[model samples]
Target: MASEGSTPQQLSDDFTDLQKKLQVVIEARQRLDAQLSENQAVQKEFAELDDDANIYKLIGPTLIKQDKDEAVMNVDKRLDFIDKEIKRIEAQIAEYSENSEKKKAEIMRLQMEQQQQQQQQQQGPA
Candidate 1:
């Protein structure tokens, strides 16, 4: 039966899928890092500004005057959201990395088994 012998193709496919998922998570984390850096810079700039400093927000090509406190609050909110997202993405990366390692081990085991089987058959009656 086909079940008597495991196919490497299936294991390869699973490993590839795991790799792709891991890559996607890594890319997402990179984007989040960039966003976090940018938001932190904005927050720092806001901290250094005078309370009465003019704050303008770009809204559909128009600069709308915004309160300094409000701008600071908005940046804080963005930083919080980004921090949460980074944590979530980090968890995903760990999971994917673990799965990928398992899949690779499984593939190696299957290859070893297949090699042993071929050797036995080639040796004929022993």
Candidate 2:
């Protein structure tokens, strides 16, 4: 129920806005997933390195020599950060999905109500 007089057009617009918000959340989740994958790969590579192996980090357009221990610590931190971000974004996606479904059902109900009212009006008084 949209209070006194909401009209069908207003309900339609609300549905559109809800769908757009859901789409934005879905896109953000996709980007975060890709970033999480990349960071996991980097973490795996660092974990597989030998203690005596020379390591270089790409800073700007140059490869800077980095200590093996420091590189390992840095990658571990990055993995943790990416994991947290992915979880947060996934939570947002779930919320948006639930909201979208509820909004869709509301829109359908509103449409059906509008059709019934119009039919009654066309039939005039009984």
lDDT of each: 0.91, 0.79
Question: Which runs of model 1 end up more than 4 angstroms from their true locations?
Answer: 1-6
Please report how far candidate 1 places residue 52 from its true position, in Å.
Answer: 0.2
Best by lDDT: 1
Provide the clashing-pair count of each candidate structure: 0, 0
| Model 2 deviation from the true structure expressed as Cα RMSD, one decimal place | 2.2
Candidate 2: lDDT over CA atoms? 0.79
Best prediction by TM-score: 1
Which TM-score value belongs to model 1?
Answer: 0.93
- In the range 7-122, model 1's lDDT, one tens digit per residue, is 78977887899899999999999999999999999999999999999999999989999999999999999999999999999999999999889888888888898899999999
Residue-level lDDT tens digits of model 2 in 1-126? 344366667766766777788788778878877877887887788789888889999999999999999988987887788788778878887876776677677778877888999999999999
